[model samples]
Target: MKFKVMAFLVAMAAAVPAFAQQAGPTTDLAKLEGGVFTVDKGHAKILFSYSHFGYSTSYGLFTDFDAKLTFDPKAPTSSTLEATINLDGIETMVAKLNEHLKTPDFFDTAKFPSASFKSTKITVISPTTGTVTGDLTLHGVTKPVTLDVTFNGGGTNMAKKYDLGFNATGHVKRSDFGLGAYVPMVGDDIALTISAEFNRVQ
Candidate 1:
């Protein structure tokens, strides 16, 4: 009876590593092949929030944007991220407020149709988290910005395509981007959160 119990324990121990391996990253970026992934617009968006005169916070999102990502599971430190959001895509639940956001005092969409970010450096904080430093161009003004990024995972989908997801947060000053409207009233600091997804481009 003791021999049988020992045999059962050994079998269970051998299966533990297999279970963990099965639960690992779906795409295993370290071994990701094919090509760069393209933003799955239907599932990607930037959600932003800012203080509203110490009363409460306001939230909004950009309706149109695109992103590109390259991740290396083995050497995540070398990965890169870039995104471009249309200045005219702001939605704040109020039509007038949304239009106001695109005016000369804010994004000035007519002159700067879009905002872009291109990473210059990447620091790996862990296998699934890291810091990305890049230049953000908005309203014709360019400044350095850093984002904390985390890998959500990736894998083959029902369509036989690879999909990857990540979440990122960063802070930026509106005044620095030429968006200095109602500065102290609306708060100058913008907290940006991005829930983005990319699919292997075929």
Candidate 2:
């Protein structure tokens, strides 16, 4: 009887750390300050590539974007992310093609000036990776989307400011969001890639 009890206790102790790691640490949002962070537009990029004309491929980037990341990384699950991308900022290699993309046939920038994403839930899958499920509004339509997110580490920059960086990508069907202006010509699937840099408020 004595030997069995001792073994049971030892086994329980070994399992405690695993349970703790699963729950992760909780961060206090009130203790952390919030501020505006530059996306490092040069280093950061938002690009989407898709098949065109059934035989060729095309890609574009939104030249203008802004985002606010509010959270304590130590308590990552509690973080909130809000981002806005100007539809009119879409840039293709050719100037004329860029202009055509913003018209009603494509993004219809006049009707939907911008696209936005707001996080509804963030789950940490590992120390360096996680998933962000949120609502992405595009073309005047809102739909739930999930982003495969990777924590790119955080630290102080040359400006003596603390910042956090992340890279995320996901896929969405443009037609589902009312952007289905094309038929079999343009691919229905749009791949979204985002690299965001957020600075901590002092």
Clashes of 2: 0
Q: Judge candidate 1 at residue 105 and give its lDDT.
A: 76
lDDT tens readout by residue for model 2, 1-202: 9999999999999988866554321223333344445456666789998879789878988889887777664577887888899988888788998988788877788888999989999999887789999999988899999999987766555566666678899998888987776656888888988887776654
lDDT of each: 0.83, 0.78
**Candidate 1 lDDT score at position 201:** 77
Model 2's alpha-carbon lDDT is 0.78
Candidate 1 lDDT tens digits, 48-149:
899999899999999998888776656666767788998798998999989988888788889899999998899977767878899999888899999998
Top model by lDDT, which number? 1
The 10 consecutive residues of candidate 2 with the worst lDDT sum are 23-32
Give per-residue lDDT, candidate 2, residue 8: 100
The reply for model 1, stretches above 4 Å from the true place, is 1-34
